[model samples]
Target: MLRADPCATILSPRTSLKEALERLDALMNRLVEADQTGAGIDPLRVAGELGQIRQLLAEAPAVVRAKDGQKHFRCEACGTISHGDRQPERCPTCGGRKFFAADIEQPFVESGAG
Candidate 1:
């Protein structure tokens, strides 16, 4: 029998942007402290933190767009909708190269009414 990785469960796609940022901040602080004190931080731990930081940075854009209600695009090949100011070079879900605007709403106009 294999056991599930706890870190994977904790740091998932559903992890909020604020939480990710907080984690990144904590990691940076740890690195700074280690650097200043000349402490021997575990090489594996540093490597893991670096990987996590990279992952968080990569996902930050999409998270910000989702929270800000920015425009979204749909992948033509896989129909995956991604939120951003512009279409991603490749679809995050399916790695599709083609995309089009997903949400194109006309501005609401009010008629003169008493």
Candidate 2:
């Protein structure tokens, strides 16, 4: 059996920033507990995920606006995000229509709110 992709699960459009942050907190707790028990921590994977999560949090609203419910086109070849009712048949730069759509959930520190 193949394991599911963590990023795929995390990139759900229904995911919320608040919930993402909460899950990050839980991961941190798990890391700490694992450290306490000397079970070894996967620092590289954790660091990579942290970076991706940070970027997602930073681009959350834009991601939603760009490709949440629509078939917006993002050029994997040129890294351009375009919003529309359909995916373009080709990216102007690379003329490639193959691309992946993922709902990005960004994480950020909430300030000035109780």
Candidate 3:
């Protein structure tokens, strides 16, 4: 069996971790179905595919790095949250930077409006 070309399976722009996992699941189902059908299951091929699927599952998250890398800014003075790259130069709530929490928890979904 010819090994899958790494270049052909690159998941930089077209695929994400979630999608990759879904694809892995689909491949697993196919392998199981093929075995049940007595379709001359090639253990070597099955093993190879399982390995490839595992790799895809492991690599899929790299596509969504930015989504998980978001940081939040919290105004310690008034407990206001700002989901931006950096804390505002001045806190709009208390008009001071004496207390700022850029490491506050960030929700995965983008909060459009306050």
Candidate 4:
């Protein structure tokens, strides 16, 4: 049986986590439906996929890394996130240099007017 590639479609940069999970949920439903109706779907494979999706849902947000292997940083003052070879010297939004240094939270969606 052919299954969707989670990494390519669901985890790809162009896809949002919320959207990916919804798509996976739809697939899981189909598998379960097949299982209940005796549609020749393997029960073990169905269980495995259910477990895998559950595990992924339980995991924390993945850390973003730079192309040069540096950890990403962000400004706590104005919530300005940065990704580069090195830490940014100043926040592009407010011109404030201080950053999270070690702890930063990058939101999936940015709020407030620019």
TM-score of each candidate? 0.40, 0.40, 0.34, 0.32
Q: How many residue pairs clash in each candidate?
A: 0, 3, 1, 0
State how far residue 68 of model 1 sits from its true place (Å).
Answer: 15
Candidate 3 shows a clash count of 1
Candidate 1 on 1-114: residue-level lDDT in tens? 443222332366666545665566666676677799796567676566567656765664431134466888867665567877777999987688998785635444344677
Model 2 per-residue lDDT tens digits across residues 5-88:
233334444555545565566667767777897866567767765776676566555454333456445565545565667777
Candidates ranked, most accurate by lDDT first: 1, 2, 4, 3
Give lDDT: candidate 3, residue 20.
55
Pairs in steric clash, model 3: 17-60
Candidate 3 Cα errors over 4 Å, as ranges: 1-14, 60-114
Worst lDDT 10-window in candidate 3 = 57-66
Global lDDT of each candidate: 0.63, 0.58, 0.54, 0.57
lDDT value for model 3 = 0.54
The model with the greater TM-score, 3 or 4, is: 3
